[model samples]
Target chain A: MSRLLESFRIALRGLVANKVRAALTMLGIIIGVAAVIALVSIGEGFSAYVSGELEGLGTRTLFVWTNRDAANPQQLTTADAEALADPLACPGIEAVAPAYQQGATATYAGIETSPNVSGVTPEYLTVQSYDMKVGRFIEQDDVDHRGRVAVLGSTPASDLFPGSAYPIGETIRLNDVPFEVIGVMAEKGSTGPMDNDDVVLIPLTTAQTRLFTVDTVRGDYVVSSINVLVQSEDMLDSTIEDVSAVLRERHRIQPGDTDDFQVRNPSDMVETVTGITTTLTIFLGAIAAISLLVGGIGIMNIMLVSVTERTREIGLRKAVGAGKSDILWQFLIEAVVMSLIGGLLGIGLGTAISQIAGSALDMQTVVSVNSVGLAFGFSAAVGVFFGIYPAMRAANLHPIDALRYE
Target chain B: MIEPVIDVRDLTKVYQMGEVEVHALRGVSMQVMPGEMVAIMGPSGSGKSTLMNMLGCLDTPTSGEYYLEGAAVSDLNDQGLTSIRRHKVGFVFQTYNLLSRTSALANVEIPLIYGGVPRRQRRQRAIEALEMVGLGDRLHHQPNELSGGEQQRVAVARSLASEPAIILADEPTGNLDTRSGKEVMAVFQQLNRERGITVILVTHDPDIARHAQRIIWVRDGLVERAEQVGDRILADDSQGSEEDKGQAVAVAALDASGTFEEVAS
Candidate 1:
């Protein structure tokens, strides 16, 4: 233990004697480690934000899409959504909020911009777990009466009514059709690509009867997709089977035919998206790890040079009684201490840069403790791996030859 | 009779530098008793340095039996030789091979550290060694911070710190001025007389060789003569010698008449 500590002291002295060279050598490891931690932390933060948002929407929820068979044009309707919501027909289903969306320009007092306009039922609020910032959402009576009322998300509401205090009583025109703003939703911010606040919601009956669709017929209607909530996470597989069966029956698909509709659990989507992101993180980290390899090579290069420069010192130590192993360990410790110092500094730098860049670029970055520990441990391993050859060279130096060295 | 501190019989060294082979030492045999101050004197390329290295255990002899304090060290492996060098032999180089950027105290502590001395004891021993060398106050000063003579003194202190049985110095005063050379020689004499430590120094200068009690003169890889240094002027040049009165008077008179060539001849 004392010898190890003495080695550390000697290593420190060696580094201090060649501060410029040591610092320059350590730069490689510093930058390599910093890149790894910074990039990985941002990746972790991004995934965390996404998964957290998904969890907010409930993991057991499933989205059913039509593949929107363009040739057949078999779009969904409110009747189909109601059919899936029936407990007797789809046993594991709890609620269904079917929605149709159109990208349109909304204007209020000449402030016009493109916003997503969604037509949904009263269960949309419960299914989405969204709360009103001010006024209430559209009620069942509004959907049944085909009321021309809309609930504006925070962004469109603020943009169209920048200075107005009473946006709930104002009228906002969606594609030249004016609708009274009945409520303003609380801001949900951005989750991945979807800006939750930059949207407007209206009743499905109003959207179908008045704003969009040529046919006014209610029985055979069209919607983009349906959001189904499973009764329980354990019941999800059976619920997907039940929902698929009901859809198959409603669409008149035979036993051998492949269904045109796509049924997906959000958690599966989470896994797929997060899987891609994780792979992307690993790919980027691997690229960053290449720099660490380069850094290790730098350490080896410097250590070799150091051994040559300190040849006489090694000889002197040997003359005094130092064994080959002692000489080897001396140089090896110098290499490790160099990189270990760099590794520690890199952790602090990487974390700081992560936080600063995160805020500056409006990105969410989380520095994982695991990545910090891993980067540090990996740097030490690099030191050992790279230091051996030079250490061996120092150890194997003949005392006579070394003493005779100028 | 007690075994000699250093016993070498027919030691030879062959140097193979790439394709060229050079025979540095053919066959040389010598011995020194305990508490002896012996100087091995030779000209450049006369193999005295090689002999010094072998005696110091820094290099193993190619063919011979070298018993250092009764241990056969010439046959020992590199590590075993290192252990011998560490525990039994101490070396003083011409350049005072002190570790640069290290304090005088630390430089003195090198051998003790290798000897597995505890930290507190190592410090204490180093302090005593430095104090013995008359650099008691310069303990914390690094080599660069000290003069050449002080550096050499620190080297002496380092050698003495281990309390080895034999001190093999290759041209100990080769790099010092006359005054510093005398001062360093005085310390060697002090260690030899006061502690009964065996000191073997290599030098080309007859003036430096006069400091030793005995001289082993080498030429062409063989000892030309092993002569007792008749009258040692080293302990104190100002005082008179009790032995070899006539020869000492003749040598001093030759020096006084400025015909010192006779002393060399």
Candidate 2:
């Protein structure tokens, strides 16, 4: 141990003697490690943020959207949503909310704007997790009575009402159909490409009768799609299977017939986004890895030069009782120290740079302990691996030939 | 039946240069008793350097038995040879071979460090060695900072610091002036006399060769003759050592200074 330590000190002295060369040698490793950290951190941050946002839509929620067959064009109805809520019929389903949507202008005291108006049942609040900012959402009674009451999304409420107008109890006109605003939705921000904040929600009966002029006696309550919430994430596939069976049965579709509805899960969305982020990280990481490879080669190059330059010294040491292994270790330790220091500096620099870039670009950046350790350990391994060739060359030199070197 | 400090019998060294074979040494047999002061004299390409390397354990003989202090060194492997070099022998080179940018004290400490001496003791012993060579004041000075003679003295101190049984000097004074050469010779004589160190010098100068008790003349891969010096340099007789001989001899092979004639008349 003492002998190794002595060699380490000697190696440090050798490096210290050539300051510029040592620093220049370390530069490659520094840049390589820094690039890896920055790219990896950004990628991880983006994936995490995206996954979090996707999870906010609820992992167990199955989206049954309209994949309308061009031949039939069979639209969904309130019966499909009601059929999915039966515990014995749909084993993995917890709740179902079918919605019919249309574009309509909401006007309240001269403040007017065209926003998406969604007609939904009371289960929409529990299934979609929409928090009430003020007043209450539409109840079962409102849907049954075909009451002319509406719920405003944050953006629509703000736009359709004057400053501090208290949207609750205020009467709003949707396509010239007057309705009292019973509640306003809490701000939920943007969901991917959709602006959920700029929407209006009302009873399905009201939308079917008062807005779309559909007859309840005919019972053809056309809905764009239904939101089916699964009981648990583990049973999401079975829930979709059960819902598909029920919907097919309810729509009176025969065997081998193509259904007009699609059952999708948020996990698929999460996978798509996470897949893109991972590919981007790996692509950038590969480029950074190439730089690391270049840095390793640089270390090898410098170590070779150092061995050649110190040939006589090597010979002298051998003559004075140092062994070949001793000489090999000396050079190896020098290379490792150079690369290790570079790795540490790169970690610091990369973290700082990524944080700065994250704030500047208004993107999330995460620096984990695992990433730092991985970079540091990899750089050291690079040092050892690259240092081996030059160290072997030094160790292979004969004492006599080396000593006699001019 | 005491064993010789250095023993070699029928020693031969052959170098293979592509398809050609160069014989550096041929059946060279010699022995030096313990505590003997000897010089091996030869011109360039005469196998003296090769023999010096063989004695120093830096190279293995092609064929022959070389026993040092009763151990068969010719049979030893590279690791064994390194052990021999580390503990049994010390070397002084013509160029000093000190690591540039390193302090003289640090340079001297290298041998002891390799020998596994503790750090504090290594420093103390290196200082003692430097002081012995009259360069105690220049311990921290780098090689480039020191004069040629001072640098040579530092090399000698390094060789002495190991406390080896035999000191092998290959042209120790070849790069110095006459005064520095004599000064180095004086230090060698002092160590040989007081500390009872066995010293072997490889030299081209006849005057420097006379400083040893005996000299071997080598020519064309063979020892031509062994000569005992009629007048040797006493350790305390630096002033009386410059006596001029009134004759001429074949000493033209070495550097000629218009001073004392120490060659055979």
Interface Cα RMSD in Å, per prediction: 1.1, 0.8
Best by DockQ: 2
DockQ of each: 0.56, 0.68
lDDT of each: 0.84, 0.85
The residue-by-residue lDDT of candidate 2 on A1-406, one tens digit each, is: 8889998998999899899999999999999999999989988888888888887888888899767653474677777677788999898888899888889888878878988998999998988888999989999999999899999999988887757647678788999999999999898876666687898999998898789755331376777779988878899988888988988887778888787688899899899999999999989888997898799999999999999988899999998889888998999999999999999998998899889878987778988898899899999999999999999899889988898776
TM-score per candidate, chains pooled: 0.83, 0.90
Q: Write the per-residue lDDT of candidate 1 for residues A1-406, one digit (tens) a residue.
A: 6776676777888999999999999999998899889888887777777777666656778888886553353567777898998889888887899988888789988899888988889888877777888988989899989899999998898899887656878888999998999999998876557787888999988887788873422466677879987878999999999988988898877788777788888788788878988988898889888998899999999999999888999999998898887787888999998889888888888899899878986768988889999999999999999998999999999888898888
Runs in model 2 deviating more than 4 A are: A68-73, A86-88, A159-166, A212-219, A249-259, B230-265
TM-score of 1: 0.83
Off by over 4 Å in 1: A68-73, A86-89, A103-118, A131-203, A214-219, A248-259, B43-46, B101-103, B118-124, B134-150, B176-182, B217-225, B229-265
Q: What shift in Å separates residue B88 of candidate 1 from its native position after superposition?
A: 2.0
Q: How high is the DockQ of candidate 2?
A: 0.68
RMSD of 2: 6.0
